[model samples]
Target: MNHPLYGYSLCAALALMLFFGIYFLTARTPDKPIFSNYLRSRRIMGVALLVLAANYLVHLLCELRFSHPDQAIFLNLSTYYLSAWLFSSALTSLLDRNYLCRNRFLRHILGWLLFTGVSAVVLLLMPAGIPQFIGLLIMAIWFFVYAFRLARRLVRTYRKAVRIVDDFHSDHIAAYIRWLSIFTYWAVVYGVGCGVLTFLPKRYVFLWVLSSIPFYIYLFCSYMNYLLFYEQVERILESEMECKPDTNLPDSEDTAPIGHLTIPPKLTLWLNGHGFTQPGLTIEELAEELGTNRTYLADYIKTTYHTSFREWITMLRLEYAKSMLVKHPEQTVSWISEASGFLSQSHFTRIFTEKESCTPARWRKLKD
Candidate 1:
């Protein structure tokens, strides 16, 4: 692969592996309810990514050949609308909760409609040929807007899931939120660059090379850092949770309020029991399983564990995911995420990076 194109191909490969990893894991497990829905969404998104990759590759390959540039390029440009449509579908899947069994006809129409709307806006404002460089810039802007909006929704959903008084994991929940924030900022920066590139002359277009290199380098370094420090810890923690003593309870402050001291033995059993089976259990549902009220549970979590229930569940999930990744190397991170309890591959990616400080791909690579 050519050097410049190779960089993107690497991303494409990573995305592809991520898709299948989730698929294999989901197929093998066949029981994670929460993750089942996410699996459907991710499959949709993954196909879209493949579409985007193919479109980009076609354009790049045609450009390098410099033969029938106009015709080849025109063919490539046609895919842009399709690529954008796919991208919109992918984003919509990410934003939606419980996408499995969703109305396929509705989804297809939504994606196509979104693509048409965006294309119409672009057409009305710009001339033909549209400058490949400038077009990329516009697309980046679209990406950033969607990324930030999605981040906000995730944060809100997570917070809503947390309880104030229960024993919960803080690090894992915080990590999820932080990762989303970082990605949001990343999107903003990419958008800013796109805006900047709009005015640059053709000769100075190579400046994009200089700008993008640093961003990619940062992403690579972040991946490395996450694998070394956090990924290892999360794996260990997950294993402990999976096999956690069903009867033995972690010590909490006895002097703690009724909410705090209310740690039910049945809940421990429930946690361990489900640890063996359930995929994608939420804190609210978990609280219900324990026969506790959500608000009281929140107070118990806040007073006894000094964290929210959401955080605690995330910690449990991460701990389990990490263990699965290490114990079942053949299994993809997506499988572990489903088995451990996450909403989607995007959610899993954000949390894993936040908690483990590395992408699942980087973590697996390190173990290899």
Candidate 2:
């Protein structure tokens, strides 16, 4: 608080955290029943953010109250350590509640308390320089360890989320998380910088703390963009609910399941009729076209085809593209990609290279 810049920064952080806390708490949760857990997560996360803001507020207050504010260093570091753990939980909640379930949250609280208790003895009782140095070293180590651990969890959870979307959808859910990758990379940098600043003077720490205002702003924006993907997830859930199987009688499709994902007669006919050559061929759309339901179609594709609905559709598109390449030598690859149901030539080429181990242009040349 002695420094005007530091005072302004703390006030700014307080406001940012307050805004984020309220947004997460009051934001409209997904209306779909399947997302109840996610809604619960948001509420818990909002509380965590508010707690973090309180940490900043305490710092500001202590700096103002005590002529020798360093007398309150223990209080400052203790609350920050507490807020640090909660902050990780808050971000994890944004990803998935399961990552920090009740058992996990309790375990984290216990560990934080145990560590804080032991460190308090050092900070409060030990001689001057020893306490500051050792306390900081301990806090820095803990912060780095947990921050790295949470970063890994974020990446893993994000990848799984993308996979889940692709498992059932052929939409552009991949786009939702593309910018999220930028945020993840920035988070790693922020963690490293903050951990280092833990050892530095308060001035440098305040400067870095100020960085969090924009960091979180960018992060929240990217996260909100993910709601578009959630909408698709809600649709899938709705389809599952509406198309739930009946126990009254066995499903005729279940009785005589196709072997090895043999294209069912109807799908075979549809394929022959070039139904797979249309862009945005989601499983729900395919099910509707087949006069079936989404759940049954998803199960059929997953169990028999040994691939996700997204990959299955992509494979079909590539096959169609290959044939088109062979027959229409003059047509551009871009034209073939769009004609064969891909979003773009680049997307088509990427998938082709991944699946075929050659570029579409090279493949066409070899075929010619």
Candidate 3:
């Protein structure tokens, strides 16, 4: 191996693995179910990153053992093991966030066994360069199929979450899932490129290998940035949860019948009378204040406003925000965002733009 580029690539992979490992260790445990999934997905991705680094290390060892026939055989076996392990780890991390799957653990285990078995068989049977192409082809097919399924499930999940809360919690989780799906899709594409390059002429193979190093390094950095963004969103969620008071209610309320409860007109009066302007206000809190079960209140909002509790609250906030913008043009967007019960300016801006077909600034300017 005359390629100095290989050494630099290996070093870069190792460095990224170390950084992600530290981040995985330091990341706080999530308090909510959505964030719990996020943390779990990140943990799995970290394991995948470590496996990738190990594969690179094994490749380095294989290169060093070229002169020693006996050692080369052993290193070659190690390379095969690491390669199969890397593929399995990557697939697991990519699919672990598919919350819509039932019996996920069993499915994941079966997938791991099947893929690993296929990879090992191909590596053992085919000529060295040929197996990579076949393996990557299989990987690419599986990734696209799985990613499509995951994307569909994520859309359904997001719709449900939107009905539950209009806040960033659901949106954050959906964004995380979308990013993971895209990452998996691109990862397979990269693997396919690497496999294709393996069939190139021996002289060109060196260049192919050299080029792959920076791509892997770039992937590692991108994932690290994604994790950092995920962590920041988690912190925002934690603060939002902390600010809201816990309402002790029966677990059965989740499935309780809300058809019998009479929703007083006072409920609307209370919401519009500056009650909806409280930051981080949740359905349960509003239900408690209304002296009704949370399910009943949710149903009431759904029936009366033809929207979910979250949507109703969001609408109220938007109306309040519009009035504030018209009356107090001097207030900054950030100030108005908070004053209108939004958790962050970004969230406010996103919703406002979606509803108004323009950004908050543009909408305000038009209204003025």
User: Which candidate leads in lDDT?
Assistant: 2
Off by over 4 Å in 1: 1-38, 64-96, 99-151, 158-178, 204-295, 299-368
Query: lDDT tens string, model 1, 220-293?
Result: 34433433333323332343344335344434655335554555676678767654235434344556677765
Deviating ranges (above 4 Å) for candidate 3 = 22-43, 63-111, 126-261, 303-308, 329-335, 358-365
Lowest-scoring 10 consecutive residues by lDDT in candidate 2? 254-263
Predict model 1's lDDT versus the native.
0.50
**RMSD values, in order shown:** 13.9, 5.5, 7.1
lDDT of 3 by residue, 127-197 (tens): 65766656656754654465445445544543443333444321223454354445445655655566466
Clash-forming residue pairs, model 3: none
Better of 1 and 2 by lDDT: 2
The superposed Cα distance between candidate 1 and the true structure at residue 159, in angstroms, equals 4.5
Clashes of 1: 20
TM-score of every model versus the real structure: 0.41, 0.69, 0.62
Model 2 clash count equals 0
Better of 2 and 3 by TM-score: 2
